[model samples]
Target chain A: MQASNAMAALALAVGASLALAAGSAGAAPPALDEQLDGAAPVISVPWNVDAAGTAAQAETLLAPTAWAEWSNVLGIDLRPGGSGMEFTSNPDYGTFWCSNGSSPAYAYARMHLPHGSTIRFFRMWGQDLSASGDVMAKLRETCLPNVGPAATPTVTDLATLQSSGSSGSFTVTSSPDHVVDNHQCAYVAYVQFPSCDATTSLRKLRVQYER
Target chain B: MTRTPFIAAVFACAFLSSASDAADFPNRDFRVITGVDGKPARSDDSYSYASGNYRCTNASTRATPHVVRYPFNLPEGTSVRYVSVYGRRTSDATPITLRLRQVCQSQSASDPTSTVLATRTPAGNADGYFISAMEFSPSPNTLDCRAWVEASFDISTTACDASKAWIQRVLLETEPSDRIFRGTFSVNVDYTLP
Candidate 1:
């Protein structure tokens, strides 16, 4: 009975979210050149946590201790009798990394949202291994104005996970502008690994946007 | 008697849906890349953006051969035919290699494997930047749904100096299809019966 009720609730939540996305007022939908009357399109970008751009930094942070755990950076235990990406401090002291600190871990996927589509939401599937640790995920947009020799780009946090649920999505409260403006400004989606502890594995990060 | 009719109905609905989906879309041009969409592969790579143009500055010997990748965000199974990149080099002799590659990553989060589908070397035009394009034969070359697509910029041969290599845009002309799905899908089915 609980399983059935949970499934039904999930379906309802999805339906509500879609309706909300479809109703958001913003730019006109791009012309579907081939399908004159087809439904608006949606683009989904999925990234593995290992795809994070700051992986080089993460490896540095994890350091030789991580090396002793896993043979490779991907956290695979190729070495004989080696544990796979597990970390347990000898003194059991608390450490906050990944999503915090001066360099947060972020995996970037190029955004090609049709010129006028609206960003809907972001979803992540991962596990927080430590009982006191947090595995937070958020979607960030970094945009650079197209009319400069080189200038500081803008970064905006579009959406963030509301809870520790295995699978969760939060609506974007910021502007729904999903245009790929080559002449004005360009945008890229960066899925952030805001907070994570040892043994935390992020299987996937997905961004959904509608045309 | 009821089970047989129910199975027949399911099949009929699926067939109709497939037929209608095919009829709705016709082959059309789809552009997925612009110069501004590219991101530097390495943190140390030097890049500049200006008026829809992306410039890779080979300023440091340590940062020579900058690689900027423009990832494709089109639907899975989309067919691509023509690809063009417009750009100019500060020095007419600067060399750049543009590659169309399909990259596949296994579920184990291991190293992503890639295959070069096409390669185009843009020629330096005396009159600033011109379009360098390649048309694939047996056209409508379908993209792999299980892999990611990207246009890789390789400026390995370019001189390592303050000189700049600029790219205005990268365009892909694709045929519109009914398969509008996005992202990679991994499905496992069990056939063992109880």
Candidate 2:
């Protein structure tokens, strides 16, 4: 009995020492990712919403060739310079603004955050070429009623941020209500560039969320 | 003291060591982004919310011209294992296609590069629902370390056929690059040294 007790104590002591050595020798501490239940860590998703090769709708009733001339609610025209989208600037017509027409023309980019994700913040990467004109980004959430007949879904702006200078990025922190409740909401990231300077553009959007 | 307590202590130590080792592997991560989170590829491709999902219908008469791209924001060095797109077709003749696309941009290059990892089009059931899946193999799988990944869904039929397709959700299954935790940790859990 004494021999067994001594052996067990020695084995435990050796095991504990080895474990302490590992923990001290750069073994990372237990983290959320290390959890057995598969709880997700904070993940940041980057979206290049302004990439080329996609088409947008035109606000005016025109041919497919002219649809890129006007910024539509679905999307916007890609800038001729690079991988970005901007409002169309026609020499014949002045700068087109979303607030100009009877029907507002705000460009939209679909947001894909993981289900049950709580948005921490999102960054808008782009250039605001004009100092006078500002670029606005609004995170809109529309939740359809579960028990109703197709009524107009209540649209809410969870957060909105903008920049007027030639900044490369703008970060908008989420409020308490920024959770992605997919059971009742659909999220859309909207960007409206009030300038037609050709350089004023929206390049990319990054969403950081926790699941 | 009794030998029972000593044996129990030894067993407890062993269990703690095993847990620490298990932490090295971490848990496989997954993300299920709904189809409503995606945007239409063009204005002519209209979408309506139905049953808590986006039902997209193409307006163009061309074959498979309508597309909806869903962006993925996983960490760098994320080994994507499987991609499954959930959707249904309104017409029996039409099929829904899911494509896994990766884009890599070099610092010296003027244009960003892109590649298609996999493409799958699943057959619809009697209820018109289908789950298009693509799985990668050989251990490491497809790593999205320095690239951008997205799942683009294409409606296989022409708009003139009155066949519409909508995605219910996209499931992305991935494993960490190495046997270590590389990203942020949850603040809710209290982690301590073993």
Candidate 3:
């Protein structure tokens, strides 16, 4: 009986050890916030002077551009403006529009990241023609995996800023759950008058990330 | 008695280990296209295409093309087994063709070389929105696969032309105030990771 009891205890020990091994193997790496001793700049997307150009121009400037700060992960090509709008640049900010008495317009910027990287937060500054008391604006993120049907896209609402009743500036910061899968690319869309007959514009936008 | 209990413990341990490994595989979603306002002249009085919608063309047009391409990539050791495409059109009976191709390294994502793997023409949903799916079982599975989609629709003046038919993304909008139509295209892929 004593020998049998010893064998049972040994089996229990073996099982427990195996469980621990499996647990460690499957555990996710430490999050970006936990990895740094102090705040360190990992990735930055500046939609300012450098990114300030016509959508047609942006298509060339943004494509195959390397994020020098990160391990040189190549950003994907940016398409020209969407169907309804035109990209315009100004001294203070870059903007796109459907103009007054014009049809609704849409525009977006997209990028590809290195596998397993995550976006911690995103920041943007913009406003709609609602200051003219005419329209409103909305921002959303569409994330897609590397492999799948092109027809289906995952859309997430980032923010919705009503017309300030004047051309005032609005800024927004994203929450942490906005993760990008290691196997997918990310698309950030700035929509003006989504339903049509409204006008909006964006002055500045930035995205911060970690490897 | 001792042998039986020991064997059971070993089996339990094995099962747990396999489960943990399977949990590491990642699943993701992507929007290849969003909704855009249909062509102005194609707008029908009954169905307002002025809002953000996509219009189909008889042949490729300067405004709305008959064929559109979207590019995507897969991680090493991962294979896609199934794809689900969701779209909505102004007309219910329009027919659309979807083709999957292997992208050559030399070609851009927007332009792929001639290596077509699968093609299907799903029947449109008379109800306006349709969800079509395709399953794939490649003979020799490959890792690090780069792929793209070539989607086209028939152009019948009376049936599926600019005036009668349009396509849009399938999105649930909570706010009616938003007017911009981000062209909508969604594809759900079932993948297995090594």
Candidate 2 Cα deviation (angstroms), residue A59: 40
TM-score between predicted and true chain B, model 1: 0.59
lDDT of 2 by residue, B1-194 (tens): 69999999999999999888645535566667776766445434556777656675555555435555554433333455676777776545345556665443211122334556677766656667777777743232111111112323344444523334567887766665443343332212101100
Q: Which ten residues in a row have the lowest lDDT in candidate 1 chain A?
A: A66-75
Tell me the tens digit of each residue's lDDT in model 1 across B18-89: 988745434454454567666554444567788877777655444245566554423223355566677765
Better of 1 and 2 by DockQ: 2
Pairs of colliding residues, candidate 2 = A45-B73, B77-B145
- Categorize the docking of model 1: incorrect
- What are the lDDT scores of the predictions, listed in order? 0.40, 0.47, 0.37
Top candidate by DockQ: 2
Tell me which of candidates 2 and 3 scores higher on lDDT. 2
**Higher lDDT: candidate 1 or 2?**
2
- Residue A200 Cα positional deviation in candidate 3, in Å, after optimal superposition: 33
Candidate 3 lDDT, tens digit per residue, B19-57?
887554223222333334211221111123435555554
Kindly report which residue stretches of model 1 are placed more than 4 angstroms away from their true locations once superposed: A1-101, A105-136, A139-190, A193-204, A208-211, B1-27, B76-80, B90-92, B106-111, B128-130, B134-164, B177-194
Cα error, residue A25 of model 3, in Å, equals 14
What is residue A7's positional error in candidate 3, in angstroms? 18
